[model samples]
Target: MMEKKLALVGNPNIGKTSLFNQLTGLNQKVANFSGVTIERKSGTFSAGNQMYDLVDLPGTYSLIPKSKDEEIVARQILEESQRPDAVLVVCDASNPERNLLLFSQVADLKIPVLVALNMVDVAEERGILLDTQSLEKWLGCPVVAINARTGKGLNELKAAIEKAKIPDLQIFNPQAVFSDNSTAEIHDFAHWLSLQSGQEYQHTESETAKTDIKSLQQARETVYRYKKIKEGMAAHHIVQSRERGNEFSFDRWALHPVWGYLLMLGILIVVFEAIFKFSALPMDWIELAFGHGIALLEQALPDGILKRLLLEGILAGIQGIVIFIPQIAVLFFLIGLMEESGYMSRVMVLTDMLMKKMGLSGKAVIPLVSGVACAVPAIMSTRSMAGSRERLIAIFVTPLMSCSARLPVFTLLIGMLVPARAAFGPLSLQGLSLFGLYLTGLLGAIATAMVLNRLMPEKGRSTFVIELPPYQYPLWKNIWISVYQKSMSFVLEAGKVILAISILLWFLAGFGPGEQMETAYNQSLETSLASGMQRAEAEQIALSRRLESSYAGLAGKWVEPVLKPLGFDWKIGVALLTSFAAREVFVGTMSVLYASGSEGETEMLKTRMLQARNPDSGSPVFTGPVVLSLLVFYIFAMQCMSTLAVSYRETQSWKWPLLQLFYMSGLAYALSAMVFQLSS
Candidate 1:
């Protein structure tokens, strides 16, 4: 049997994607539309004996194309290439009047349509009722009320889809809608449609015949639909109740001028604290497991290059990948909760006024908040913004928002510099320090947005209109899925890069040219023998000397002079150079370098880092000042290659990403130098 295709369409924040997720579950995958970065989410589902392919189109308020994402939706609706067999229009039950405008347009296209009236539960809670049977009869189509979050009425909605059919009567006349418009483009489009549909067109010659004909027609249609819908509701006796009187009362405090900001700040502090305190146990377990695995490998394999590579290169890289899973998982879980409960939309509303001063639309808040998870998707989210200039600014500043990838680096450094005890009346000093780092990044992002707003040329004025979705209980299933998918993506995507670099670094640190390594080993052996050193001690000294003369050592020495002012040694210089590929690779690089030099120590990477010393001075390398300096550097540096590539792709130009790289790196260097100098 042939598979049927269906297109899912709705206005923004109407629960279209949630319904799609319910239908497709784990069978869905995301792809890009042709010649655009806009995402195309397609999936397959089986109903009875028949299979269906569903495409979740980007949400839009109307058929008008104003942005890249909206353009994709409009093109898919108008173009005939690979058109769906049917279209499912999702609408909010509480405000069906506002949402029916798109449905009216879709019905005019003369396609088979099925209406899924979603959020019925929310509508009922808000003391609103919809007469579904009367509405379905009035529209001459099936209307099934559904709650996408809890899978309520989903089966009935699917059954309606199975029986949906195209109606013979068209609700709105396309020719009449555009015949009297002054815009040449609209007139031309109307004439073409009339010719195709075999209808007559009535053209107007007056240019001032109310040039806003489109808006006027939309207003007329909206009034007409609402009037008909209200009559149907009255005939069916759908009444409003007073059970949920306080449903919208909470908005008074949430949207307040003063209390809103304080509430947001307190919420952020709690999120950061949860991330640090909850992930500690799991992170420790992962560290312990990897350390034991390395020890087991050492005991099983014979002493050779292969054994060294397995223990130091492969295991160390894996350790870097696994140790951060807990942090990444927790970050996404909290973000998902905020989104599912509708708190994120409130945040957008709260920041809208302040964001306008920075020349960004309130809609840019979604991408900026999402950047805390990962910058790639966050940058993509900006495509929904209505203006090009705002989108570009949002993309450019998002990377500074302290993503989950930075969590590992920040936690490592904070663990070294700050103690685990409470300070300032029962607050964890370490947790507060972490919170400060996150705040610093957020402030930097806002400051950068302001600067870019002034620098970038303006294309058009952007508006910030958004629907504040009502708060609801978050679904545990969705939260778990989000956390799992995001955490796995980080490990798989970054793990590949880390593993390859770790092997290369191991090779460089293990081998050297000519007899330099042999000469150093011989000199160290002679000195150890003259000092009456034991055989084990002498072997360790010789090994250290050999590592110092290896290729990695020479490369480190080459950059040592440049990094000396920042309190970094040759070994740190090497790690810094390798970390350009990714920020997390710094931990893996240090692990491999230190493990390769240590003969048979079973210490974890953190312990080894604490005990490390400068070969010449024999003083601790990771002093408080040095750790803080490194932390400052990572906080500001554009060290991730993947983020740079994504920025270039989104902007379609090298200038922005390259400028970002240099500006961030320069800032990192200057700040790190200052911190090192002041602290020392």
Candidate 2:
């Protein structure tokens, strides 16, 4: 049997997503909508003898869209090719007037829709008691009150869906939808809408033809719909007490001008510390497991290119990325907790003023905060911003924020530069460094936006509108699912890039043009023995010398002149070149290079980096200035190709992405050179 298709529709923050998660569990997959970057979430579940396919559409306030994301919701509902078999309108019981506005609009479309009145418990706690039977009678449809967080009424919702029929309701006539003087476009749209509702479209002429007739009609229509809705809901949804809840008390401080910013900063510090402290043990275990696996493979397999490829190329590179999964998962878990608990919305509200000062729309806060996970989705999220210039600015500056892909490289470098025992009071130096780097990225983004604001012509700005959800305990299952999905996404995406680059790097480092590698090995061995070095030490020296003469080394050497002033050697230069594919690939590339250069050594990448010596002066290669310079470089550089591609897609032009790449890379280089030169 064909599965019945249902779409979950509602305004933002109505527990619609929570209800979807409860229904789908871990069966859902996230993809892009047909021709847009907006995320599409869909899944399937069995309902007794029947199966159902559910899609969660983007949240919007009304059918008339103000942005691309909202446009998708409107199109999906009204277009014949994409309309769902039924729509489950998730409404907030506490805010019936606002939510019912959307519900009434959906009802007028004459499509089958069932009301999933969500957050009933919270509503009752606020002294708002909703009469489901009365609501059902008014709408001529079934209404099921559900608490999505606790799985209450889930079975009933599924049952209601299984038996749902076309709602015998049309709140308004399509023929009378438009004003007599409406434009041709408005008439055509209404005509199209009427066709879907099986209603006739009528045309009328008037002496005055307003160019903005659609907006005028929509405003009038909204008032009309709400008036009818209020009359229907007057007695059914009762508020027994007008008392303020704890939400008000909390918001007093959480949205305060002073305390709110401090509280938010303190929470961020704690989150960063937790990411470092909590992930240490798991990261160590992962490293140890990979180390042992590599060691076993080294001992069991004969010395050959295949063994080297398996151990040095594949295992080493993968370990570089896999060991960071715990940190990535922790980051996502803490972020998910903030979002699920409603604090994220508060953060957006708090930062709106500052964002405006930076010449960014208030909506840009979502993409900026989300950039911490990955810039691709963050760039894609700029579609929600109303103004074209604001959207472009958001897309351009978002990549400056340090994403999870940079986390591995940052952690690895920080561990080498700042000792684990170093601390400032209760905070570890490494954690502080991590937070400082993130702060730097944010500041860089702001600074760039300020400059862009001055350079670009003024486009009209949209007012910042946001709904603050009441504070609640996070749902652990949802947090866990989000963490798993995000961590796996990082692993799968980074793993592929690392594996391909590792193999290519290994092959290039293991071979050289003509007899250059053989001559370098022979000459290095002879000189080392002549200096009275032990045979084992001499052999290691020979291998290192051979690596320096290989094809990858030649390329690294070619770039060394340009990078020399930044305190980077040829090997570091090579890693820099490969990591353009992804920021995290810096770690994997270094891992592959070090493993190929160091024979008969089983030390971890960190140990090898710490012990590394400059070939010319024999001093530590990763000196204080060099490490600082490198960190500064990665912090500012547009190093990921995927981010560039996403930026192009979001802006629909190569000029923006290309300019972003050159600007970021140039800034990274100039800043790194100054840091190294001044520090040295």
Candidate 3:
């Protein structure tokens, strides 16, 4: 049988994606539409004996195109070639009036439509009720009350979709409202249709006409639809109670000026603490297991380049990526919970005034908050911002917000520099220090936004528009899915880059030009024997000396002088260079570099890094000052090539991303230098 196509359409924050997830489960994938950067998420599912292809279109309030994302939605719904066999319009039951506007517009398309009244539980809690039968009769289609979070009413919704039919309802007619002066494209299309039907064109307009006839007509249509909706509600006795609700009471504090800021800070502290406390056991187990695996591999294989490559190059790099999975998973889990509970929208409301001072709107807070997870999608989230300048500023500075990629770097450095003991009652000092680093990144982004606001040209005033969604219980299923997806994405994306760099670095560190490596090894062996070192220790010393004469060592030496003032040595310089491919690669690079010349030590990367010394003075390389400096650097550096590429794609120009790269690199260097100098 031919697979039927279904489009999932709704306004922003209407639980549309939740419903899509419920229907598609694990059968979905994300891709970019042809010739466009906009994301297209499609999935396949079986309802009864028939299979259906579901496309989750971008959320938009109206058919009018204001941005690229919205334009895609308009084209997908309105163009005949792209239109689906049927559209499932998901509406928030808690606030049906505003949601019905989009539904009315989709209904006017005269396509097969089914309404999914989502968040019925929240509506009930808020003392608001909807009469599904009455609403279905008024709209001339099926209406299913669904709880997307819990999968309640899903069977009904699926049944309705299987038996869906085009509604014989026309909520509004353009021909009745548009006259001779209308300039909308809809009016032009109506006229063309009339001509094809043997009638004369009834509308004409000069290009200079100042009237927004389409908007005016839409406003009128909205009012008419509300009137009909209200009458149906009255007939069905659907009404709201007079008492104030729990969600309202909660928002009163969550959105307050002083308390809201305090609560947000507390939430951040709790998140960091949770990341440290919850992930500690699992992280230790992973590190220990990998260490044993490397030891077992070393014993099982004969001494050769292939054995060394397998143990130091591939396994070590993968271990670096996988050891941090627990922390990444926990961070995403908390973020997903906050988002599902509807608290994040309130955060946007609370941060608007402060964000305005930075020349960003409240809406910019969404991307900024999401930047903490990963900047690629965070920058994509900025497409919903109203103005180009505000969106650009948000994009340029968002990289400064410490992402999950930086989490491994930060955690490793903090473990090295800061004590693990508790600072207060139950909060670990290391956790507090980690939170401080995250706060530093946020402050850096805000400062950069302020500076850019003054320098960049603006075409128009920035607007802050947002809707406060009703509070609902977070679904553990959704949270787990989100955590799994994000954690896997980080591991898979960073793994590929780390593996390639590790192999290349292994070759560079293991081989060098001419007999320089041989001479260094022999001299080191003689010096170690003269110092009366053991045979095993002497061999390790000789191996280390040989690595110092290799290609990667030469490259690090070239940049050593510039990095000296920032408390970084040649080995760190090498890691910095390799990590530009990805920030998390710093850990992998260190793992491979430190493990390359070792004899049979089975210690983890952290222990190896701690034992590393400056060959000239024999002092520890990762001292407190150097560790702090490196931390500051990673927090500010534009070290991820993926972020730069995404920024370029988002802006559609090399100019912005290039400037961003130079600016961030300079900032990182300057800050690291200052921190090193002050601490030392």
Leading candidate by lDDT: 2
Candidate order (lDDT): 2, 3, 1
TM-score-sorted candidate list, best first: 2, 3, 1
Model 1 score (lDDT)? 0.75
Superposition error at 86 for model 1 (Å):
0.9
Candidate 3 C-alpha lDDT tens digits along 1-680: 99999999898877887888899997877766666666688999988878999999987776545456666766686667887999899998877777877777677776789999998777787777777776787778888999888899998888889656666445565455546444355543223222222111112344346545454454554577677656756776555442346775688788777898899879866876676689889988987888888889889999998998898778866875686678767877887888888887787787788899888987887678767767765676676676678888999999999987798789778988887798999788997898799999999999999999998865445666667766777777768767776666656555566566667767777789999998998998999899999877677668767877888778888899999999999889878987786687677557656753332232366788899888789999999899999999999999977677778877889998999999999999999999999999
Q: Please give the lDDT score at residue 365 for candidate 2.
A: 72
- Give a tens-digit lDDT track for model 1, residues 516-591: 9889989989999889998766776687668779997788889899888789888788778777666766765575
Poorest lDDT segment (10 consecutive residues) of candidate 3: 194-203
Model 3, residue 580: distance off in Å is 3.0
Model 2, 298-342: lDDT tens per residue?
Answer: 899999889988986788678756866777778778878988888
What are the RMSD figures for all models against the true structure? 5.6, 5.3, 5.7
Give the range of the ten consecutive residues with the poorest summed lDDT in model 2: 195-204
What local lDDT score does residue 552 receive in model 3, on the 0 to 100 scale?
Answer: 74
Clash totals in order: 0, 0, 0
Write down the worst ten-residue block by lDDT for model 1: 194-203
Off by over 4 Å in 3: 35-38, 119-129, 175-180, 183-246, 300-307, 370-388, 403-437, 564-569, 582-631, 648-654, 674-680
Report how far residue 219 has shifted in candidate 3, in Å.
4.6
TM agreement with the true structure for every prediction: 0.83, 0.86, 0.83
Q: Quote the positional error of residue 549 for candidate 1 in Å.
A: 2.9
TM-score: which is higher, 1 or 2?
A: 2
